[model samples]
Target chain A: MKLSIENLNSFYGSVQVLRELTLHVNTGEVLCLLGRNGAGKTTILKSIMGLVEHNGSIMLGDCEISGLGAHEIPRKGIGYVPQGRRLFAELTVKENLQIGMLIKGEDSHSLDRIFKLFPVLKERLKQESGTLSGGEQQMLAMARALCLQPGVLLLDEPTEGLMPSMIASIRDVVLKLREQGVGILLVEQRIDAVLPVANRVAFIENGYVKAEMERDELANEPDLMRHYVGI
Target chain B: MDFGPFLFLATLEGLVQAAVLCLIALGLSLVFGVMRVVNVAHGEFYMLGAVLAWWITGWFAGNPAIGFVAAIIIGPLLVGVIAYFVERLILRKVEYDPEATIVATIGILYIVQQLVLITFGPDARPVDTPFYFLIEFPWFGYSGYKLLVICAAIMLLLAVWYVITRTRLGLVMRATQYDRETAQNFGIAVNQVYAIVFATGAGLAAVAAVLIVPIQQAHYLMGRDPLLLSFIVVIIGGLGSIRGTLVAALIIGLSDGIISVFFSPTLAKMVSTLLVAMVLVFKPEGLFGSRSQL
Candidate 1:
C-alpha cells in the first residue's frame, strides 16, 4: 500500500466531491472503498490515478501525483483498472497488452511476466479484446495494467455485476496482489466480497471519507455499517 | 494530310491531359492521406512547379534536352522544400481545423499566384518542348514531348506506388492514420510522419507539373484546371486508397481521350460528371473506400 491521500477535495465542473477526504494504505495492504451509488468511490480511485479532474494530493512514498494526466501517471508506477474495462475493442488481446508495454516503453520482462500471471490470456493472446467473456476480459484489463509494473494498483469496481464465482476469483486475485506487496485501492459495491480481503476500509459518503477503520474495528462496528453503508 | 484526321489525333492529346490530371489527383490523395487536410493551394503548388520548370528549362535556352532533365530533377525537390516550410509554419497548427486550414491554404494560393503574375506577367508563355519532332503510331501521331510526358507520368506513378507500399515510412503513415493515439503509444512520432507525408505529396505535384509544362502553355493561372481534374480523380477514386487513385486516373484519362475524339468537349465533360454520379449512387465509398473511411 504505502499510499496516502490527505485532505483531498475534488470537483466535476463546480460540483464538489470528496470533501476533505483522507485515507491511507500500508505496504501489502488491500484497502476497499465501501459506499452506495453516487458514493464517489470510483471517483476516489480515478482521481488518485489522475483519470479525472480533481484537487487532491495523492502520494506514493515521496512522489506526489496530483492533477497529472493519465498517460504521465502510469509512467510514475501507478496502474488503473478503469470502470467498464475500456479495452481497445478492435485491438487483439496481445495487441492491447503490447500497447501498454509500448506506452511503458518496451520491457520484455514485463510482457513475459504478465503472460505468466494470466496464462489464459497467453493462450488466447491473438483474440480480439471485445470477444473475450466478462471474466476473461477482466483478466486481460488487469493484465494490461500489470504490464506497467505499477507500484500502486487502483482497481475500480473490479467485481461489479459479476457472478459469485467470478467475484470470488477476482477477490482471490486482489488478495494475491496484496501478498505480492502491491499497494491496492479497491472500489467495490460488493462489500462482503472485499471485506474478507481488505486490510483497512474507508466508507465514502457525500464525496468524503465518512469513516475509516482497520479490518477488526470495521467488522465489529455494526452501527457504522448500517448507518453509513446501509448495511 | 487529312483534316478529318485531326479528330483522331485530338483524342490522344486528351490522354496527355489525363496523364497530367492523374498526377495532380495523386498528389492530392497523398496529402489528404496522412495530413487529413484538403490543401486548396495544392493547384498553386502544381502551377509553381510548372513555372519553376519553365524558368529552369529556359535557363538552357539552346540546350532543350538538358533543360528537360533539369525540370524533372530540380522542380519537385525545390517545391518540396517550400512546401515543407508552409506545412511547418502555416498548415501545421491549423491541421485539425479543416475549414480554417483551407482558408489559410487559399491565402497562400493567392499570394503565390499574384507573385507569379507579378514576376512572369499576365501573358501566357510558350515553353519549348525538348524535342519538336512528332512520333506517329499506326493509329495516331503526337508531339514527342507529349509522349515523353505520358511515359514520365507513368514512371512517376509507379515510383509513388512503390514508396507507399514497400517503404517503412508508408507503414507508419497507414498505422498513424488508423489510430493516432495508439500509434503514438507504440513509439511512433506522428509529427515527423505528418511533415514528411506533406512534403512527399507536394513533391509529387511538382513532378506532374514538370512533365506537363511543355505540352501546355505555362502561366500564373494554369493550375486551376489541374486542380479541378485532381478533385475529380480523388472523388472517383476512393479516399486514401493509392491503388484506387491510379486506377481511376487511367480510366478517366482513357475515357476523356476517347470522348474528345468522338464528341464535343462539353459532351465529354457531361459524360464524366454523369459517371461520377452513377458511381456515387452505386458505390458511395468510391472504388475502394471502406465503410469506416466513408
Candidate 2:
C-alpha cells in the first residue's frame, strides 16, 4: 500500500502551518521528513493523521482519508506514534497495548508479537507506563501503534531527547518494520540518525517540501544535503 | 438510652449514610475524573431518580415489592438516557469546556428541578420498602430496609469497581482520562467515551437515589444536600481519584451520621464544609491526588 498526501495545507486557528506539502511513502520503505523547528514537519504528519484541520487530499492507497476524523484515520491503516511518546501514564503497559487491540477490534494474539518486538515491554507489562524511562516509553508507544497492524506508520520525532544507545535501538526497530513491509513516515531533526534507515528523504522548509531524494542520491550529493537540510 | 446502644445505633446509621454517599460521590468523581467536567446537574439526576421511583411505585400501589423492583431498574435507565442526550446536545456544542460545562450543568440543574416540580409536583412523596423484616438487636430493633440499603450500595460499588478494573470498557475510560488526544490517535472514539462516561455517572447517582428514596421522601428540593455533600466528598477525596472518593465518602458519611445523631445535622454540614476549606487551603491537590504534573 502507498500513503499519499497531495497539496495539503494545514492551519491552527487562522495561522497557517503547512502549505501545499506533498509527500508519499510506499510499503517496505522509510521516508524521512527532515526540517528545522517550525518548518511544519510535525504538522505534515498531524495533517495526514487528521489530528489537525487541513485542506487537500490524503490517500491511503485508494481510500481518500483527508477529511476523516482522527479516530477514523487509524482504523484506515494509519498508525501514529505522536511526539513525546504520549502513553497513558496511569495505565499498565499491558493495559495500554490492550487498548490498541480493543480499538482495532483485534484479539490479544498480536500482543506476543509486540512483546517479541520490544522485549522490555514484556518485563514491564504490569508496571504503569509513566514509570518507564524515556526510551522505554517510546518503545511502548511504537508497540501500541503496531498492535493495530497498520500498513502505514507515522512517527513524529521518535528519537528526540533519547540517548545514543536508545537512538540506535529505535533505528534498528524502524529498519525491522521496513523489512516487515510496513511503510514509515518518520519526522526527525537528526539527518545522520535517520539517513541510515530512510529509503527516501524529503527536506521540508517554510511548510513546503523543498527537496526530495533517494538515499543513494543523498549519499552521492554531500553539498546538496548541507544546502537543503543544513545537516 | 445507655451509651453502648447509642453508639451501636450511631455506627449503623453512619454505615448507611456512607453507603449512600459513596454511590453519589463516586458518580460525581467519575465524571470529573474522566471528562474534567464538573456536572452541577448531577444532583438533579439523583432527584429525578427518586421522583421516578415514587411515580413508578405509585403505579403498583398494592405491591410495594414489585414497584420497588421496577423502579430500581427503570429509574437509572431513564436518567441515563436523559444524561446521554444532555451530553450530545449541550455539552458537545460547548466542546466540554470546563467553565462552560459548569454553567451549562447549573442551567440543567435548574431546568430539571423546575420540570420535576411541574410534572411530579412540589410535595414530597415516599416509596415503601420491598421487604419488611426488622432485625432485633439486644438493645434495640432496627428497620431491615435501611440495612438492605447499605448492603445494596456496597454490592453496586463493588460491581462498578469490577467493571472499571477488569473490563475493556474500563480500560478505554482510563486511557481517555490519561490523555484524550492520545486515546483518539489510538483509534478510540473519545467523544463516544465522553458520552458514555457522562451517562454512566448520572446513572450511578440515579441508582443511589433509588436506594435511598424509601427512607428519605422524594421532593424537588431534596437534591441540594446530596449535591453539596457529593461535592464535599469529591473535593476532599480528590477531583478524579476513585479510591479517594470512597474513603472520603466513608469519613464524611460516618461523621455526618454520628454528629447529626448527637448534635445537629446543620452542625455536621458546617464541620464538613470547614474541613473542605481546610483541605483547599493546605493541600489543594487533595488528600489522595498526586501533586500536579504541571
lDDT of 2 at A195: 83
Clashing residue pairs in candidate 2 are none
Off by over 4 Å in 2: A105-109, A219-224, B291-294
Evaluated on chain A only, model 1 obtains a TM-score of 0.94
Q: How much does each candidate deviate at the interface, measured as C-alpha RMSD after superposition? A: 5.0, 2.1
Query: In angstroms, how far off is A196's CA in candidate 2?
Result: 0.3
The prediction achieving the highest DockQ against the true structure is 2
Worst 10 residues of 2 chain A by lDDT: A102-111
lDDT at B86, model 2: 98
Backbone clashes in each candidate structure, one number apiece? Answer: 3, 0
The best candidate in terms of lDDT:
2
Residue B157, model 1: Cα distance from true site in angstroms: 5.2
Q: What is candidate 1's lDDT per residue for B46-65, written digit by digit as tens?
A: 98898898889888878788
Docking class of 2: medium
Local accuracy by lDDT, each model: 0.77, 0.89
Docking class of 1: incorrect
